[model samples]
Target: MASNETPRQWLKRTAGRGARWTRLSVIAGTLSTLVLLVQAWCIATIAQRMVIDGADFSSLTLPLMLLPPAFIVRGLLIRGRTICSARGGIEIRQSVRRELLERIAVLGPFWARRQHSATLSNRVWDQVDALQGFYADYRPQMLLCGIIPLIILVAVAPLSWAAALILIATGPLIPMNMAMVGIGAKKRQEDQFQEMGRMSRHFLDTLQGLSTLKLFGISKHQAQEVHTASESFRRRTMRVLRLAFLSSTVLEFFASVSIALLALYLGFVYLGQFHFGMYDHGINLFIGLFILILAPEFYQPLRDLGVHYHAKAEAEAAAEDLMPILNRRVFERDTDQPAWQPEASIALTLEGLSARYAGRASPALDNVTFELHANEMLAVIGPSGAGKSTLLNVLMGFMHPEAGGVSIKEGTRPPRALTDIRPDDWQRQIAWVGQSTVIVSGTLADNLRLANDAASDDALLDALEQAALKHWFDALPDGLDTRLGEGGRAVSGGQARRIALARAFLREARLVLLDEPTASLDQASERLVMDALARLSSGRTVVLLTHRMELLALADRVLMMDQGRVRALDTLDALRAPQGPLARPAATDIPERRDV
Candidate 1:
């Protein structure tokens, strides 16, 4: 979480971690300040010597000798400040990025589902870019602005109190004016960022749904939506630009006005019309001339502070959006439990399970009791909206049940809820093949390695052969090394599914969960997939969720689901009897299978 401090306070907090660098920067800034003051004093002394005493050039050589060292010190200080600032900026950027990545990992699937991909992408890149100002430009400029003016006042006061007083009075006005102008600018900048995020999200959604729209002949309508989103984004950005320009104009006006007022006062003293500090003598002409030259340098840092304030405002807006993700509630349940290591065969049970979505009237799964012993296959059959997929999510520990629990039993200990089991252990023991497979952009070997990083070339080939994809791989120019396009777009749908199944086979998990794995395949592809599934489930626990009744012959038992509850569970033959609740409907497309 970001500190809710004022800008100055927040700047202080950010710099506090880099105290050593900050101290070095401050020292350099101080040296730079002293050099500037020395130069001013030397010029003033030289002018006074010439005008008041009518001195020659030879007599003024000693006073002019002080210029080189002051310039050299000033240059060195500037270089030091630059180095310190760069180091600080890099450290801060790395720290923030690390924290953001950790938060994302902690939030897990819940956060990923809720967040727009483009918005998250922008936060990871653009928002972090925006934060560079707090470390690089803002902190250093703030130090200089806060410290240099005081140094100038001390240097100039003894020489000409009138000039010092005028500078001191007007110096505070620059930042104050900026603050007033920026209040509205910050709000507008935030709005612009939000609008940009909205546009990004809409574009991503449109791209994802473009295929669907094309299938339905409505892609042209989606294009119109894209155009509208783009224009809205453009208008919001113009508003942000308008506010930025107005802020700059206001800061410039105040800076110019302050400098002009100081100049007016200096001119009066130059004409011997103003006096201060009990001297009946009018202001010294040489000192008045030097003060005029030095006044702008004193105010220069303040003007820079004003400009960087806009950058800070933009950064804060980004940070505000990021804060909720960093502080989200999703990861609060992870405990300090030991890692799970099962000693015997894996068995699973769901007892009186019921779950509802966050804002739903009724449960998606109610009293859904079932069990699968080791090396057994269970087929779950249901209509389109009968919660088959939801059951898989709960059994896989991706979702928690509202009224019951999923448990794993072993030889010794009492049955433990799936929630209590370590996630790494559960994931290591289970492999999933869903209707939509993930085909990352990589070579065949590279994709296989995702399931088992230590799998040898021979092992990969064996898995591919089992999934009926070995001939496809062999025909490719590079064979195992052939590169697949993004999401395996280069491959046919059946080939992609085979690759996914090959990945699952390579994992060799104790349990396999298949969700409509043959959904869109042709007859030959479906037979190949079912054969592959039979081979993979040879010695593992298998749960198959499908609508095809012909596949039930492969299962040891079949569970029928209706609404959110399990209607019946029995052997396939028993469930197919005339009196069974799962008796085939008149419109069912499935053909009964004969014994092999």
Candidate 2:
């Protein structure tokens, strides 16, 4: 995936890594070629015996009996070729997708946010599928096209050097013309894939935003935009198809003309106008028929390779998109890194911490610093654009700091830098409740078990009770087994948030991070969620971000932030004293929580 690598070179390198599969395909194709040579010889010999020898039907019985089984064996070999090619395709495609998924896992949500999910899904699924024919059909045929023609030439040379030279001379022309058409065909295919990706992204976005469009009464206008995009994609696809068809036409033109030349020479010699290209017998039906039969077979593999050339072009297009993602460098915890386990509670410290996003002019968190004590609730109250969420993200091991650092300590052990801690180990020790929850396509119990897979039914019920969802749970037709998320019954936003809270309650972690846990909720739902938060935070160190005055009562201290810098970190009483920015009077006027 180096920048200097051409698309063809990149594909060769990737497909080379899965050489075992490619080898299987090549071997199958070679066996098929050998069988085809035998089949052609058998058919030609039978025709020569009957036409030139004028043999009786009784004399032809032996060859007639053998020809059927020869064809049967050839058919079986062709079947095997197909099976081997398909298997190779499946194995290679699986390898690419597995590697892609692993790389994406290391990059995490930061990468997902920057890309359209539909685009990624298409590349992983449909684009990978496109590579199947390249490995299965095109690659094997590439070798067959080279080897099979030489084989035909060698077999024919013993009969007539004239026909042998014709095949040899014309063989190069097919691949030469193929190379000429392939360059433009490949470029067109790549452009078509890009257009497809854009269409998918646009369509998915429009679908997700349809409700908003309806609200603004511009749904019809948006529909026209979608239509235009779809039409553009259709036109691009047709262009690719035309190029593919043009390449086949050029290959067939060369192959047909070569066969015709061989036929013309054989025809003249057969009719006695020409007396050359024979081994003393001048020209007989046997040799002439054999050489003529071999002519088409000589060019058959090349024609097939040309036909499946689009598979190669399609796979190259997919690889152009896939290679960058596969080669992307992302921070991943070493598997050999020591796993850290804390005793009861943990304390955290941020010293002059700073983080900047790509293409941003300034750091999202600049010289920000704070401390959280064990078994204490610390609330961060910050205006919009004050880096509150960035701080939480760093604590959750989702973002790496660009400058300064964070450290965590438990019991008597010295504090360790956050970078030194493996994310999986550290994340296992804490539970988080974000503003919006991800309700996956599964049952309620399945989602809850993601937090603590070992939790029993009783444990799950207790967690639901703690999240103030017991009443809703009782009304459920299927209770915890009810399917939620997409393609299932939908849950209210408040219910979804509470389901997330239930997951947190099941974790029983000593550290909890809350990001406006009750934002945008109805007053009653907010009260219920706050009650759940109160129970979930008991005896746990907590970091909460909120503009809700009611939740500030739960915080022992408050960190007031503005413009990516901490203005003050002091007790709630101190922050509420006289002229403080977060005083009761000013806190009441602050808007509902918003992400920084």
Candidate 3:
């Protein structure tokens, strides 16, 4: 997936990675084509013996008997080719989709949130599916177009070189027409995909914000907008389909013309207009009929290729969208198992740390330095867009800083750069609860065990109890077996955050990262969340990002930040002093509901 590689090249390269499956299909298709040649020769021989030599039907029994089985064998080979190619497509699609998911995961939560869910879904599912048609239908057909037609030419050459010459001349017309049609096909497919993505993104946005639209009395307007977008997408899709159909029609016309010209040449030889096409310097019924019979078969592969040509165009368009994400620089990891052993007493230091997102003017964390000892609860306070949570992302191992760095030191161990720590082992030590909770579709017990999937149901129930989700769990009809998340049951905001807390408890990690976990909860929900947070942080090191002042009660020290730079880092009482940087103001008081 080089930056300058064309989409078509990318597609072929990706498909080539699974060449074993393509070879299986190509081999079967080649066999089928060879059988087709035999079938044609048998038919021509039978007609010559019966009609030209005045042989009786009884003498033709052997060839007649062979016809049915030849037809059956050819059909079976064709079926096998189709099945092999289809299965190959399935495996390739699965592999690509799995790779896309892994890439998404490694891109980290910040990258994940930047993508709109619907656009991401379309890229992973619909776009990946587009690649299937290329492997399943187009690849084999494309190869057969070259192999089968040449086989036809070689078979017919001995009987009538003139027919073979005609085939060679006329055959290029179909492919030429395909080339002209293809010039527009790729653009149309690209347009269609773009429109589809635009429509899907808008539709999903409207759906997610439907309540807001209605509250603002603009739902109808948005409905109209969605309708407009859908209509535009429909038109683009239709245009793409029309381009595909136009290519097929042109190809069929050329193939039919090629076959007809070959027939006319054979007809001329039969009427004694010419005798030079035959090897014997005299035309016979067998030679004439054989060439005519195989005429259309010569162009058959070309015709099939034309029909499936849209698949290639679609795949190329999909590759254009897929390559960027696939080629993204994912978080690095150790190939071998890392032998990192952090001591029980962990200390972390950030020195002149500067960081920014992929495309941003200002750094998200700018020369910001900090230190934390084991079991210390560091509360980071900042206003909106203050980069408070960005620090948490860094601590959570989601991303790296552009300048400066973080290092960790364990008791009796040399300091190691945080980036040197293997991501797997580094992540295993930290449990994170973000503002938005992703509860995948699963049973409640399954959702709670996300960090430690092997956790037993009883252990999950206990963790839920510790997180104060026990009452919510008890209210469910199926208890631990109750379905949650998408398409099952939805949890309230507080419940979702508490569910994350339960996961943290089950994780048994030494370090915890909480990103405004109780940002928008009501009094009771906030209290429950705070109580659970308190219990979860009892022994674990916690980095808490908060905007609420009341939540600062749990912080052993407060780190105030503004515009990606640290403003102050001191005890609350010290920061509240009149001469201190964060001198007390009524505005500094966090909204109520800090205590459990």
- Cα lDDT, model 1, residue 182: 73
Candidates in order have lDDT scores of: 0.77, 0.84, 0.84
404-460 per-residue lDDT for model 3 (tens digits): 988987777888888887887888888988778999899988898788989988889
List ranges where model 3 is wrong by over 4 Å. Answer: 331-337, 586-596
Better of 1 and 2 by lDDT: 2
Q: Model 2: how far is 257 from its true place, Å?
A: 1.1
Q: Tell me each candidate's TM-score.
A: 0.85, 0.94, 0.95
What lDDT tens digits, residue by residue, belong to model 2 across residues 1-596? Answer: 47667767877876765577667666766776677677677777788778877878887777777778777876777788778777878888898899999888777776677789989998899898989989889987887777878778878888888888888888888878778877887788888888888999989999999999999999999999999999999999898888888888988999999999989998888687877766765567777777777788789898999889888888888888888888776766577889788886889989999988889998889998878899899998877888888888788777788889988888888898878878888889889998889989999899999899999999999999999999999988898898988887798878888989999988888789999998878988998899888988888899999988789888989888877898888987787778766566646465565764
Best by TM-score: 3
Where model 2 places Cα greater than 4 Å from the true spot, the runs are 1-4, 16-18, 54-62, 280-282, 584-588, 591-593
Please tell me which model should have the higher TM-score, number 2 or number 3. Answer: 3
Q: Write the per-residue lDDT of candidate 1 for residues 8-72, one digit (tens) a residue.
A: 44445555666677667767877887788788777887888888878889977866788777888
Alpha carbon lDDT of residue 34, candidate 1? 79
| Worst-scoring 10-residue span by lDDT in model 1 | 587-596
* Count of clashes, each model: 0, 0, 1
